[model samples]
Target: MARGISLNRRTFLISTSGAAAGVAATGLAGTGAHAQDGALPEYAAWKDPDALIVHTDRTLETRREAIGAPPITPARELFVRNNLPTPPLSATDDPDVWEIAFEGVASPATMTLGELKRYGVTSTPAVLQCSGNGRAFFDHEASGTQWSVGAAGNVVWTGVPLARVVEAMGGAAAEARFLTGTGGEDLPPGIDPLTILVERSVPIEALDDALLAYEMNGEPLPIAHGGPVRLVVPGYFGVNNVKYVRRIALTPAESEAKIQRTSYRIRPVGVEGDPSQPSMWTMTVKSWITAPLHEPSSGAVVIQGVAMGGASALSSVEVSTDGGETWQAAELTGPDMGRFAWRPFALVTTLEPGRYTVASRATNADGDEQPRDFDPNERGYGHNGWDAHAVELTVS
Candidate 1:
């Protein structure tokens, strides 16, 4: 019944009809987290504290098992990655009154959150994944958080269409070649702003599907997940989706922010980062198993997991019980959520009592498929190697 609502209309993630069908409130089977010291962080109210592995006050990772079998991940089960530190609520006490500056258009102006909402509201499903999502699989000891496979989730975002905003502002400048967004996180003192500022720039083509998102998964966007407003660029890496976005600039060239210049670039393990290196802009084809963490019962065991087409629509998902030696097509269930969303898949087959390695491979509509070994990079970004991401399980 819930699937019918989403299938009938692509406007919202789950329509009011779905709620009427008794699928409204979140009933997470996953664990929730609480601070050992009796303090609750900004995400405490909406997040499952136990389902998340806290790396720090600024970084939280979702447990793979907690991902469950949902086509659209619950807001409470999403991962959180803050570049610097999340600013206080006092700054955004009146979320609707938050201001944003628009530049490089014919008529540059600063508009409040409420003003932008007048343009129109639309929703789309996309994978919000960290560039270093599969970093732990690398042997190079990546510099950032060592994520396994849970630093990503498929969620629906509702917001004003970026193109419409640009048009209302008299369209982008003819010289504009990039779309840059500046986040509202508080900058640390004593550090060069250029080096630590949370700003990112993507190609101008991205403006076509971008959004000044104010909602997530049919609920108000949480502060911990970029509340007042955010820049949602479909098919791009999470870093490009700036949180608490304060500025949208159409520039002749990419912003000179540190994140766009020297950081978040893909380079050789020993190489120094420079503007010439390719930035971690778009994601790559990826998928992973999310079940059977321990021994499964001796009988028919169903293998379940999620797969996504990074920059294109997913074409198919293949499952292999014996590593990559053999493969079988897995059935993708749930309503199709378009190009940028991840699909939940499952394969049910009888397995005798024995140890087995399980792996899943994803192919995108563009014909890009997962590789067996991901190349080692400086920051361990975009590691989608099926062999390295495989899971081992013992059935008894």
Candidate 2:
């Protein structure tokens, strides 16, 4: 039996303990606090307490400053957004004890983590971002967490490729059109688990780059971050990643789980969720200034930030000190982690001593450009408009 676990690292960013809270309101600063004492359980504390803003018991938002200039977000500073309560740590004490069941294959079978890792391994750097990352910028009162840009990160996942798993299972069925993943989180008793289940179904083509991940950011996937075995679907929204994925089935149609049939669907404001609404799938182009965000001294202000091309490769990033009216091409810096990962960008220019609004727009190989205004949606999902994300810079 192969206790399947392989992790690799190319250290590009140093781990910072955390930044000082209370950024001056007189200058370029927004939210001031690093930690907000919420009633969430200890599972939320696995991350650096000083590096996150507690939005809810199950949701923790990383501080924009703590996100830093690194393309790979440190696990300690990475945002935490569990669709359900974190399962007890004891259940995840042994990684090899985990198991996964495969269906809709020529030979349907179940395999323990130990047996699965023998198939071969691979790693991929991807933009692991929530579908509601920029929900705070939305004009409407969003339904879920009001996450800003902090609810995202660039993470390298190590796991057995879904293709290998399919091959081991004797290949998928001819009629399979959807790849569905079911989360293994323990649900509340006295209720139907399917009612609140976290199961997602994506196009069968997505399996080309999918993986049964057991490691995140070159470390044992933390229980809070989905320890035993999670499904990593690169180039898709975070919700589609399906943490704690214990069951994967290739089916003819999408999962009928309430989450899929109703929740996370993008619809017009005031409209109720139905089958016709667009599901939050792949991400859109987005970028936000990370440095010079705290009060910066006058003179040479080198603005820096991170940008992602969503489902495609990032082609270019442009900065605008005067909001969206004027734009200038910004230099893409650091290692190109791949099409699924984000690229760090910097704009070197001195701003005149005055108040200014700063923003960044990103374009992808697919020609998907970040818009100045995001269309209104019922849940405020995927708000990547550049103008609404603009930051105010007060330079002396």
Candidate 3:
């Protein structure tokens, strides 16, 4: 449950009472919204081939039935985000043949995967998300993987605490403020790397909670995923979790690597009104409705899904049947994960015979709520807080 919770503050503010006026009752009638069919919906803006946008919206590229108790999402059900194709490596390769070198530190060292495991490390379940999760909404448009909502997932990771390994290497150097991990080299254009092959890093302080996870979801790492070894950074986007890791190092400044320097950033919170304006970094409160999606037929429907926060734990979840006019509170479940990832939720209601657009907005304990829409940005890295997918449903 480490990845379950809500945002800590409100991401936006609206005059609920004013918007509610003149709105028809019994489920989004006069709100100018429509309902989506029970079938998985297709995306409206898939013009960009590089980016894949995934929201709780109806156009889901992939969605499997929820599985397991304590509910560790199954490996097959677990989502995937790979900048590169799955690699093809021989299983018989000797552990000694694989080497992990430490660089950028005062006294760097290199060791094989077997040697590191002998140090007695452990693992935990954590959620990994793509920083560009809701990128499809960027008004100006950006390049790179345009992932929808399904690009993220939770896994039970088994690995050595990065701190343990770093400390063993004569503790961290005083000048070191960041840790960089380089996975195996990227192969030629056509050669597939069964695992994700890339380099990524994080702040040195974050190492205390980072992991060198070798196992995922209660099983040995699969080749499709990062096996042998991978970097597991909780809370941050999946880009930071470098797969097929081969080397790590301590650095004096923030990493300016491809993934870090060119990607994964959010406009300041106040920029929602004007996305073109420059601002500081801040992740907004956001949530998505997973069930009763599309135009649900008339009768009882269970509204359920999850929400997350960047700096705050989620405080409340609200639903608006008539656009943003009216709001009703939904039940929150498992707020123990501390808001980095989403915790499931539900809201039961009866639908009328009509098309409706269902949306879920979450607020952090700090009073920040999700925005109806955010100003367009160039990169479209952090697109949280905006009104997620509007599933058109026919309640006949």
Candidate 4:
């Protein structure tokens, strides 16, 4: 069994508060005395309240909620994603020394981290979630990390608008549709034979709302969480949020990098193909119920979860108390941040003590509704569908 799975009650309370603060700090830096310190340090262990919510990416997906309201995952509870542990660089390593280079573009250019920040930067709260977020839910064994539920999270990310950065590297033409980003991570042997060197890219249109963020939760980013800089695609999976970014190239072609080529793509729906099959690039409409703690609770229970689409607007969210046998509408909240963010929806309901299953289904205006159960994939690349959580309630 994977040991990185557990959240206790105490931790939950703490994380909840921190997440709330993060929501408040969205688009702004922290005003706390330690505002200059940076976001909370990664937990010694990746555990949360109830020992039920375990985050392999150090709670990177903790920023998301189930149904009620969208709470900013505070720096404290914000998820941490590190392909590798924190790489330390001394303060003396001149901020001016941090430079970014662009290749495979019409006009490649290099700029220091400081210079990039001075460019057209803006802040927005986006949900940076992992493509394999719900991998554990798959019936078939997957190849990569078997994340149970907490592999994804949402946060108030602050950074320069991606489009502005591209414009700085020589204006983009209408034909330039893809932007490939090469980061500093190198693949270790025996991982994936076809693994593209830790590089990833997205369609240029996706950059309209994408961000080249250097700050997370309103402070200089921690290296463990893609410090220096990273890409934040508004509605895409976390895999697309390439960390330790060193390059951003605008191209008129599609991306076939290792990460984009071998991973993150989804196979045909309703069919279980080879895990290693090449497939579609778009993400499916998805939602999840997060409240009632998935545990049976008596009296009024608040239900909450998030819904997202690839490049579409979320239309509606529905909930089912008795599994999917019956459904009721849930109140949708939050503004459509972009392709990389999920909208929060919530409803309050009363429950009787007993075992129960709750689910949330989201639909995008494009008429794409989440499936009750998505076809299990061999690679567990995409697991977006209706989220069904089972909880037991006891009453005296």
For all predicted structures, in order, the TM-scores are 0.89, 0.90, 0.71, 0.74
Please provide, for model 4 over 183-271, each residue's C-alpha lDDT reduced to its tens digit, 9 standing for 90 to 100.
76655677763454656667677778778888877877656567767777766666667777777777766455655565555664445
Candidate ordering by lDDT (highest first): 1, 2, 4, 3
Badly placed stretches (over 4 Å) of model 4 are 1-70, 84-86, 89-96, 173-175, 186-196, 252-257, 267-282, 294-297, 333-340, 387-396
The prediction achieving the highest TM-score against the true structure is 2
Model 1, position 171: C-alpha lDDT score: 97
Error of 2 at 102 (Å): 0.4
lDDT of 4: 0.59
Ranking by TM-score: 2, 1, 4, 3
Residue lDDT tens for model 3, 1-396: 011111100001010112122011111222112112222112222222112112223222233113111224556555445565444555314433456887765557998777788767676656666666665444444554343344455567887787877777777788887777776645666743322246665667668768877788776675445666788776666767777788888888655544454344444332332323332223456676556544466888777766665545678888755555567788876545555555666777888898555667888878888877665465666666435433334577
lDDT of every model, 2 decimals: 0.80, 0.79, 0.55, 0.59
Model 2 clashing-pair count? 1
Q: What are the runs in model 3 whose C-alpha is more than 4 Å off?
A: 1-61, 64-71, 91-97, 104-107, 187-197, 264-284, 334-339, 365-368
Name the regions of candidate 2 deviating beyond 4 angstroms. Answer: 1-40
Tens digits of per-residue lDDT for model 1, 183-272: 998887898888888899999999999999999999878788888789999999999999999999999988888889988999999998
lDDT of 1 at 34: 27
